[model samples]
Target: MLVSALCAMLGVAPVWVSCLLFAVAGYALLWLFSPLTTIMIATLTAIAVLSFVKPHAGAGSAVIAFVALTANNMQNNLTASNIVGMIIICLCPLSLGFGLNLLLARRQAAAALKQRLDREHTARHLHDTISNDLAYMILRIDQASHRDPPFDQNQYQRQLADLRAIAATALDHTHQAIRQLEHTDGPSTHIVQSDGETDKQVEQQRKRLDDIIQSQRQRLKSLGFQGDDILGTFDQPLTDDVLDLLEGMLNELYANIAKHADPNVWYAVTVSFDQRHVIVSASDALKDAGIQLGLGSGLERYRAIIESVSGTFAVTDDSGIWSAEITFPLCRRL
Candidate 1:
């Protein structure tokens, strides 16, 4: 509008002619250069401003119209004030993105710090409590072995009593530390159905768990793994809570395999039930045996969960192979 008004005031060309020229030049430059058009327009504008070559209306109008169109194309204004405005516009998003990145980094740092502090606290507690008790117990046993008679019944009994007391104290201290650690993990996941839960709900939960197991078996087959996925029959339906826990554990197992196991190698996932317990076992060949697999926190959490239910969880790395087993006492069958 401003360029057209200026052209009209100078009696050089009609307003519509100036607009048409701007539209044609902008379209042609953009269609031909695409991304490079931004650089070309900038360069042309800079040269025209710096060289101070005042061409007549015919040429000047084309250049002015193009410069204005370039500014408009970039969603900016072609005016002296817009120089600072453009700088502010570009910096706004950059500053926002940088601020968000800093916030994320700060949160990550805080989480890492808290984890370190917890580990340090656990270390200190073990040293202060268990280490001293173990040392004293060892010394007492050593002294007992050096008795002159080697079988002074009364003295032996007294030493045994003292040892028992020390052992009990150490056990209590250990339990205390474990309880404190457990508290930090928020709520406990109990694999037992609530008293109010119905049998139909339990059946649905069991079906969901069976579906997950079937999917895992299909995935193993699709991945070209040789495995016997023996999803054994359950004589009695498992509780909903138990099913939920098993679902999570199953997902974690498959995810770990997907990440680290070699699909071409043989693998096995077996589920069985005895009178007292339900057993799950899995083994896979590692993709990279040279890389030692650490006992990651995920396995540790599951270990704790199994133990909390009076169950056992074990994992081992034998050469290039990894195996894990979890056995939990049959959750009060629905």
Candidate 2:
């Protein structure tokens, strides 16, 4: 309805009126499309041909002008027929503009779909290569836990910390995914200089890692464990992707400890960086109750995560103690 009324604004019969009709249609088409140059030639040609036409627009005027022009041999003047023709001519641009906009909208939608597929490829790359390591870390924790006896309060506290870490990391991923899907002309996306934003994201990664380590360590300390108790130290710049992988591993490790590790044992989790490596080592001088257990597949997944970042990984089983070491290299950080 609005389209028809707006089209009627060019209802008058004049060369300028035709220009106005085409101009409005062209603008609408441009709005519906991207890379305006792609459709500009077609738009100009169609508007030029269709916009300038017979002027008689109303039903009665159309009949009168036709009779005057053909039967009475009149030439080059607005007659009743021109009035009807103007209505029909204006209607052509209106319909053509509507159709062009629809076609352009479809093109935009296809482009958006392609961008989404590209984003999914990126996400799958991370999940397939890195996230698979969570399994290995969990298995080690479970192996240790089976030897320990239950201490309700300590176990619960540790579990809570891990659960929060898991929740936080999942939420971060979900929001990041959503942004990837709906990203265009938003404040979160910078149109200009993005170095500051990168710095800010790196800072956030550091903070999240610190919080996870601190919370779990606090639980350990309350039970008279300190110094060598669940220690984690980060002394280097961190990337968001590496931070996410580490966060997931840490949370899973904590959960495994809460559920499987000896309640009375000491554990140290440390993170330090060198020119070539951002290394993480979790070692526990586990007080084994000598419960024989099979090693789970979690270690394999852990190995995959480390290797995906081009890091050397080791899961050590020696003299009744278990440790998983990952040398996450700075050279390969993403």
Q: Each candidate: what lDDT?
A: 0.64, 0.56
Candidate 2, residue 124: the lDDT equals 48
Summarize candidate 2's per-residue lDDT along 86-122 as a digit string, tens digits. 5554345545555656676789998898677556544
Q: Model 2 — which ten-residue stretch has the worst lDDT? A: 51-60
lDDT score for residue 305 of model 1: 62
How large is the C-alpha RMSD of every model relative to the true structure?
Answer: 24.5, 14.4
Tens digits of per-residue lDDT for model 1 on 118-220? 6755654565445545655675566556656546789767767878876886798799779867766555575665644546564666577678667656645
Clash numbers, per candidate: 0, 24
C-alpha displacement of 35 in model 2, angstroms?
Answer: 37
Give me the displacement of residue 207 in model 1, in angstroms. 3.3
Q: Name the top TM-score candidate.
A: 2
Point to the candidate with the largest lDDT: 1
